[model samples]
Target: MSGVRLVMARHGETAANVQHMLDTRPPGLPLNERGHTQAAALGARLAADPVSAVHASVAVRAQQTAAPVAAAHGLDVRVVDGVHEVFCGELEGRSGRAALERFMAVYEAWWAGDLDARLPGGESARDVRDRFLPALDGILDGASGDIVLVSHGAAIRLAAAALLGDTAETRFLPNTGLVVLRPDGDGWALEHWDGAMPVAGDVTAGGTPA
Candidate 1:
C-alpha cells in the first residue's frame, strides 16, 4: 500500500455495444437506454467513495460514463487522451461478433501471449499498453487517495492483465464493470472487481444534474 489506489471501470453499454458493433473513437455513438441505466447504477455505487480525481478517455462514451460519479463527488472529469480505447482502425464500426470471427485467427495469436499482434489496421496489445501504462503511471505518481478511471473494455483488460500478471483472457472485463487496484511497491494489488451493477435501486443517468 505504498502507492495509489486505482479504481478502473469500463464505460457503460452504448448503442454500438448493445448492437454488438465496434466503437473505437469519438464522437462515438451515445449510450443506449440500458447503457444509461447502467451508468446511473454505477454512479450510485461509486457515490459513497472518496474520489480525489476522476479521469476518463476523451471518447464521448467514456466522458458520458464518468459524468455522474464525478458530479456526485464534485470533481471535474479530466479527459486523458492517453487512456482511450485500443484503435480498432478498419474494424471501428463493424459488428462485434463479425469482428471477433473475422479477426479470430489474429486474436488467438495475440491472446496466446504474442501481445504484439494486431487486427487488420488495428492496434496491438502492445500498442495499447504503450499508451495506457504511462498514463496509469502518471496517475499513480500523483494520487494520494482513490481515483476513478473510466476507459474502454480492451484497454482496461490489457492493463489489468499487465498489473495482475494474468493472461489476456483471464483479465477481460465486461462493460461498466469495476476493477480496483492498490499499489504495492513496484506493482499493484487486486482489490475487487464487480463488473455488473447491483440489481436494486433507482440509478441516475447523464452528465446533467439530477
Candidate 2:
C-alpha cells in the first residue's frame, strides 16, 4: 500500500479509571486486572495485522496495553514522549462531578477548535498537537506496514480530530478503542472508528461510511 495504515488505540483502564480519577502523572499507573483482559482482547483483535512498528506513550498504562500487540508482531514497544497523556495538572487525582465536568469542558472546547484553552496548571490543546503531531508523523513516514500506537484517551482523540478532521462517531474512544487512518493526499482519511469500518463506495465525501 502507498499509504500508511495507522491504528491508534487508547490504553486500557487503570485503577484511576476505575475510580473515575484523572491519572496522567509520570511513571503512570499500571493496568488493573480488567484492564489486562481488555489489553489481551485488543491484542487478539489487532494481531491479524502485519504490524511493522509499535509505539506507545511513556505512560505505564500505554506500555502495558501495547505489550501484547507488540509481542504478537515480535516487536519491542518504542516509547515516544510526545504521545503521553494530557497533563491534567491541578486536576490530577481529583475525581468528582465538578472536576470531571471541568475536564470535559476543556476537551469540548478543544474539539471545537479552542486550542489555546487550558485547564489550571495544565497544557493546552495546541501543546498536545505540537508534541503529538511530530511523533505521529514520524511513525507514518517511517513505517513500511500497518502500525499501532498505544496512547492515552485525550491525546489520541485530539490527534484524530486535528489530523483527520472532526467525526462525531469518534468523539471519544473508549479504553482500548481504536481508529484507523490512511493518508489521503496531504491529509488523512478516517477509515474506521468506534468499531465501524467503511464499505467501499458506500461512504460519503464527508468520510462517513454507510
Candidate 3:
C-alpha cells in the first residue's frame, strides 16, 4: 500500500438531499438532524483510522459533515475551493421528478465522457475536473499519511470516474459514504467502495486488512 491513502467521502444527507434539491452555492446550506447523525457515525468510524489531514469543500454542508472527523483528530478542516459542489446554474434550488431527471441526464453525459456538457449557466465536466483534480493532487503532494476529503456526491462521482474510470461504483456515492484509493504506479486504484472497514489493520493505507 502507498503511504498516501485518499478517502473521498460524500457529505451526509441534507435537507436538500431529502428534498432532492440542488444547492451548489458556497457557504450554502446547513445539515438537517439526520445529516448530523450520519456525519457523526462517519466521524466515529474514521476516528479509528490514522487520518492525518481533513479537507472539505467550501460549502457549508461539506464543512459541517467534516466537523466531527476533524474534531476527533484534533485537526482543522481545510476548506479547498476547488472541491466545492458543481455550480448547478439553472438547476439551483430546483426539485421534483423532472428536475432530477434533467440533472441525471447531464450527469450521465459526464460519465460518458462528454466533458463539455453543462446545465444552463453552469459548469461542464471539464470545469469540475480542472479544479478538482488539481486540488486533489495538491492534497496528495502535501500529505504524508492518510487523508480525508469530504465533498458532494455528484462531484465525487464525476471526478472519481474521470480520474479512475467510469464504472458502477464510481457513478454514485451515498451520503456519508466513502471510497478508498491508493496510488498504483501513475494512477490510482480503488481499494474500497462504500463498503465496511476492515475489522483489523494498520488503518493507515485506508483499507481493511486482507
List TM-scores for all candidates, in order.
0.86, 0.88, 0.88
What number of clashing residue pairs does each candidate have, in the order they appear?
A: 1, 0, 0
CA lDDT of each prediction against the hidden true structure: 0.73, 0.78, 0.78
Model 1: ten consecutive residues of lowest lDDT: 201-210
Give the clashing residue pairs of candidate 3, or none: none
Positional deviation of residue 168's Cα in model 2 after best superposition, in angstroms: 6.8
Q: Over the stretch 1-210, how does candidate 2's per-residue lDDT look in tens digits?
A: 474699998888788876777788766789999999999999899889878989998888899999999988899999887888888888887876677767777766876768999977988989988999999877777567788999977787778888876653454567888888888887888888764433433211111100
Q: Can you tell me which runs of candidate 2 are displaced by over 4 Å?
A: 166-169, 195-210
Residue 35 lDDT, candidate 2, scale 0-100: 94
Error of 3 at 119 (Å): 1.1
Q: In angstroms, how far off is 209's CA in candidate 1?
A: 29
Question: Considering summed lDDT, which 10 consecutive residues are worst modelled in model 3?
Answer: 201-210
